[model samples]
Target: MNIVVRDTLEAAEAAHVAVKQAAGLAAEEAALPFKQARLRAEEAMRNNLTQAKVLATRVGRLKQQALEMARESQAAQRQNSTTDAHRMQDSARELMKEAQELESQAKGFQRMAEATRGGLGIYALRAKAAATRAAQRVNPGGDGPLLLPPPPPPLRPAPRGSAK
Candidate 1:
């Protein structure tokens, strides 16, 4: 009888260990998909951040070019080259519009990056601030006073030559 009771106790202990091991394996299997999803999300966030940086750089260049063209247009107008001034003004307007669009795109990317970053990590905060600054620089006045110069006067048709 003693021998049978000892064997039964040992068997119960073995069964307990086997159950625990099976539970652990099941937990890990259940978590596999979640882990994979997290990794994919992180990769996507990294790609978005890289693209945002590129866009911000492009916006900066476009803003600078637009400002320079605006200055040139003002100079041409001051020099009384009406046709040249009008041309430069049109070019500057187009450049500024493009810059504005790019700036908006950058802002959207930044928002997504921030949301993915999660928590209050210093690096994430700094990146968000930098993105905001870049957008501000691109747009400048932002519905307030106009940064670019006013449009040039409308073009006038040249007078017809008098018939000989």
Candidate 2:
């Protein structure tokens, strides 16, 4: 799982102002691009979810087929034939597990996309804050009291393979 920083007043206010800065689509002309963006994003997400469902369905079919094979193997075993029911049973179980994993992965990706989209405001704020910090550092004391809000803490790096 990812460890996100808890929002402090500094980060929160930056995000608030950033939202304000990104707003104001008064003109219908100004809104066209935004509307197109919204549509594109939604379409991509829909397609992704559809593909995930298709893959999950395939996995489910594989699981059912495995179960059918297991049943047939058991029937053969009952007739004193040399079919390994245990192997078929294990394969069926593994296929079932694969189906569950596929579903879980799809859900996780969906949430991640949502979070990243929602975090774009924060991303914009971060860009402004970084610029402000650089300006202040280079021209310290010379600039007439920059009234910029304090820069946010650096984002922590996610651990490798951590978001499983």
Candidate 3:
């Protein structure tokens, strides 16, 4: 009779532990989708950032090319040569078209980046709001800014030959 009771107690303890472990596993499984969504959102944000960098570089190169073309056209005009003017204008027009196309493409990238960033912002805000609500429930007086302020603008060098 003593041996039977000991066996029964051991079985009951084992069953309770198994149920607890199963509950923990189920909770983790439920959270898996949220974790995956967050990861995917982060990946999209990173891709947008990379695309923005590439577009910015391309836009800079295009602007440089446009400036060079304008300088050539100006030199041709100053020389009072019809042939030079025609050649320079044609070259300038071609460069202008290329530059315009690059600008448009860059704008498209900018829009995409903005959209991705906006989506991430909304997701983060929702998560923050949820966390805040949970925290308020746990401790009725916690207060803090959920979002950080924007960064300061970059400083640039002064122009050459400009007055102080």
Q: Which numbered prediction scores highest in TM-score against the true structure? A: 1
Segments in model 1 whose C-alpha atoms lie over 4 Å from true places? 118-164
lDDT of 2 by residue, 79-162 (tens): 776547666667777877887787787676667557646644653455455545554444443333224444355644345445
Candidate 1: worst 10 consecutive residues by lDDT? 155-164
How many clashing residue pairs, candidate 1?
A: 0
Tens-place lDDT digits, model 1, residues 1-164 = 34444455556657655655554455455545555656676787888798899999999999899999999999999999999999999999999999999989998998887787673354444544554454444434332332333223442222334221
lDDT, model 3, position 42? 79
lDDT of all predictions: 0.68, 0.58, 0.62
Q: Compared with the true structure, what per-residue lDDT tens digits does model 3 show for residues 71-142?
A: 887887888876887777787777777767877776777677678667765655555555545545543433
Models ranked on TM-score:
1, 3, 2
Where's the lowest-lDDT run of ten residues in candidate 3?
A: 143-152
On the 0 to 100 scale, the lDDT of residue 21 in model 2 is: 39
Clash pairs (backbone) in predicted model 2? none
Error of 2 at 64 (Å): 1.4
- TM-scores for all candidates: the values are 0.65, 0.44, 0.58
RMSD of 2: 21.9
